[model samples]
Target: MNRGLYEADHEAFRDTAREFVIREVLPHLDRWEEARLIDRGVWVAAGTQGILGLSGPSDFGGADQLSDYRFRNVLLEELAEVHATSLSSGFSLQDDIAIPYVAALGSDEQKARWLPGMCSGELIGAIAMTEPGTGSDLQGITTSARPTGDGWVVNGAKTFITNGIQSDVVIVVVRTDPGGGRDAFSLLVVEEDMPGFSRGRKLEKIGLHAQDTAELFFDDVVVPHENLLGELGAGMHQLATHLPRERLSIAAHAVASTRVVLRETLEYTRTRRAFGRRLADFQNTQFVLAELATRLDVTQAYVDASIHALNAGELTAVDAAKAKWWATDVQNQIVDACLQLHGGYGYMTEYPVARAFQDARVQRIFGGANEIMKHIIARDLVDRPDR
Candidate 1:
């Protein structure tokens, strides 16, 4: 499918993004993977090139009015073509996860304190929601911020936080009013200079190695009252509202990645031979690719539609969950099969397919696990007593 989702301006942005990746990103991926994190300098470089601020406002040194998701989809697509998933991941966190608080919920002072630094890449940002005892269970979080004289004192920990260590400022999800039921949670911006705030090890993961996922701790750390993001009682609602864009972004990457591997797999199968005959000549290979292509198209349609719905403010959490899970599942299947078609070479580090295989495994796990996503989708279904 041609995926008629972008205007010429988006194409122009794609060209710029492609050049950024070629010039600033791809050359550093291996080193980043080895170091287990992206250097902070690249973030600055990205800001200068205007790749880091898709959703940020023009006043904040960002692009003009690309708060729409379609622009983001194009950014992901261009980056995905080169298998630069880590770069895509970092950009999504900045745009999808962290920036919105400033855009939608920040006080004028808060936005002033953050947005300029963010746009300049001078002050990095992160959101810490998943804790030691809770992963996807948002309401089950244990991090606490109790009342202090002039502020609130936060304590407890978070794990698997993207951009954790590198972040100069972190948006921490904590229980502000314990025993107030699910509405007790609140988001507080914890600066790195805050006392007793610490980071645990940079976690080793199955994929997305370049992402700086780590454990963060707040021990009797005081957060000024002004650091609170959004209404305290509305934390869940805020998260729910923001998650659709995040999941949709992930789905976009899923489809883009699938196409990359699928393209590579097709070329490989056509040239590589078995018993003096091309692997593409095999009925089994043909059948599998056919099925993969169909899956790709169907999944692509859902993703494309979800993008449209998102722009229209009509994409629900359930539909976003469905798109995220299905598209990633399709990406996983296509990449795995594509790898299998390459035989042992697929397992080698030198092969891009091999690296892609490692990278694609996490798609279904993060952004809410596929199982969690299905549960969300199931809950979103309209109940019929007669059925």
Candidate 2:
């Protein structure tokens, strides 16, 4: 399929991204995974390579490729080609989720203070939304920030935060009004050296080991009013506006990963012989690959459409939800089938297919869970004005 999603510039950018991934990311993956943390140097290298903060304004030392998401997608595809999913996840958090929030909503002063460092990779950012008691329920957030004479005092804890350990600044979702409702939440920027702020243990996960995921704590941490991101009590609205991009990023990665796994599996089926014949010669193998190839192309079409809608500033939450759930589900299905085709070798951790299987499990779980995605789509269906 000639998707025609990327122009000549995107292909040119892909060349740069591919080279960077091979030179900077691939060799260090194993070492970082063993350490359970990615080295900070790679982040800086990515910044220098103009890969970290594409959406940021150029005056702030960013690449300033704000409206074009194809560059980001190209970079993701390159990472997937080598199965560096941990780095892929971390970079997506930076480009798709965290940086966009600041770029979109931060005031000039706030932008000047944070955007330069963030774009230059001197600062890493994390969004602390999930708490011990809350996952995907922003209304249920217990993290509180109260106004004081000087500023606001924040007290809360967040878990399952990507970039938690290495984050130089965190955008924390807090309860600004004691009486909780839609208008009660606000976003506050919590810096790393802020008093009474601490981090918990780096969590061990089933995959994405090189991406630092950990717990964050804030107790009587005073954040100045200047650190406030966006309007007070508008966090819910802000989150809703930005979520489409995050979900779309996940979908994009899912499609790219499935492509890689299927490609590798096809090569494996062609070479490895059984019963005096190649595995690809078997009817069963042919059927599986044919079905998977069709599914991959179909999923890619929708996801690419979603990406275009996003670039045009027209992608809805419902549409993004559809892409996120469907693409990830397909990704998992393809990986599992391809792994099975490898027979016993699929179970071994050494093979890329096995590693991809382990990494693919969390795709459905995160980005607001596949169950929540269906709920979003279903609610839209029933609540439409035409209905």
Candidate 3:
């Protein structure tokens, strides 16, 4: 099926992204994975190549491409082609989750101070929402920020933060009005070297070893009033507004990754022999590939439509949730099936299929678990019974 999603400009940008990945990313992946951290130099190189901050303001060196997400989609597709899940995840955090908040909601001073560095990769950004005790329930967060003479004193900890170890600026979600209900939270930007601010050990995971996921701590860390983002007590609203984009970004990666692994597996089956015949000659293999291909195509069409809707500012939270959960589920299933087709060799770390198998498992768990996604969809369905 024809995707018809990318224009000529997007295709041209895709070539540039592909070249950048081959030259800058692929060579360092193994070393980064071994060290459980990516070098900051690669980030700088990406910045120099105009790969970071694509949707940021033009004054801060951003390409201001927010209206068109196809550029970001192209970059993800290229990264998927090479099985660079860790790097993809890291970049997505910066581009999709962190940048949008700063670019869209930060004050002028905040924008001037951080956006340039962020665009240039001089400063890495991370958003701290998930606490040790809280995952999806923002209402349950206990991280508190109390008023002080000139600033707010923050005390709390966040776990499972992407770029947690390397982030130079963190947007911490803190409770501003302790007794207030949904409007109690606020976003405070915590810069590096703020007193009492520290990081826990980089977490070990079953996959995405090169991506830095860790715990962050803030005790008596002073965040000046100037560093606050958006409305003082509107943190929940801000987060809600940005989540659709974040989930759509995840869905984009999920579909792209599934396509990459499927293509590779198809080539492998055509060449690898089984019982004195090509693996592709087996009836079961053909049927499996056919089914996977059909699923990918159908899911891709919906994702593509969602992307267009997002650009048009019409994508809803419910729709984004649908795309995120369904696409990730498909990605995991397809990748697992592809690995099974590889026989014993699939279990080896040297094979991309084995690595993909490890990386795909988290898709269903993160970006609000698939169960949460279904709940959102069901709630919407119930509220609008006419549809």
Where does candidate 1 stray beyond 4 Å? Answer: 64-66, 382-387
Residue 349 error, candidate 3, Å: 1.1
lDDT of 2 by residue, 1-387 (tens): 699999999999999999999999999988887898999999899999898888788988878876888889999999999999998998888888888999999999988999888887889999999999999787999999999998899998999999999999899999999996999999999999999999999999997877899999999999999999999999999999999999999999999999999999999999999999999999999999999999999999999999899999999999999999999999999999999999999999889899899999999988899999999999999999896
Clashing residue pairs in candidate 3 are none
TM-score of candidate 2 versus the correct structure, residues matched by position: 0.99
Model 3 per-residue lDDT at 286: 98
lDDT of 3 by residue, 233-339 (tens): 99999999999999999999999999989999999999999799999999999999999999999999999999999999999999999999999999999999999
Model 1 weakest 10-residue run by lDDT: 378-387
TM-score per candidate: 0.96, 0.99, 0.99
User: Where does model 2 exceed 4 Å of error?
Assistant: none
Residue 213 alpha-carbon offset, candidate 3, angstroms: 0.0
lDDT minimum window of 10 residues, candidate 2: 59-68
The clash count for each model shown is 0, 0, 0
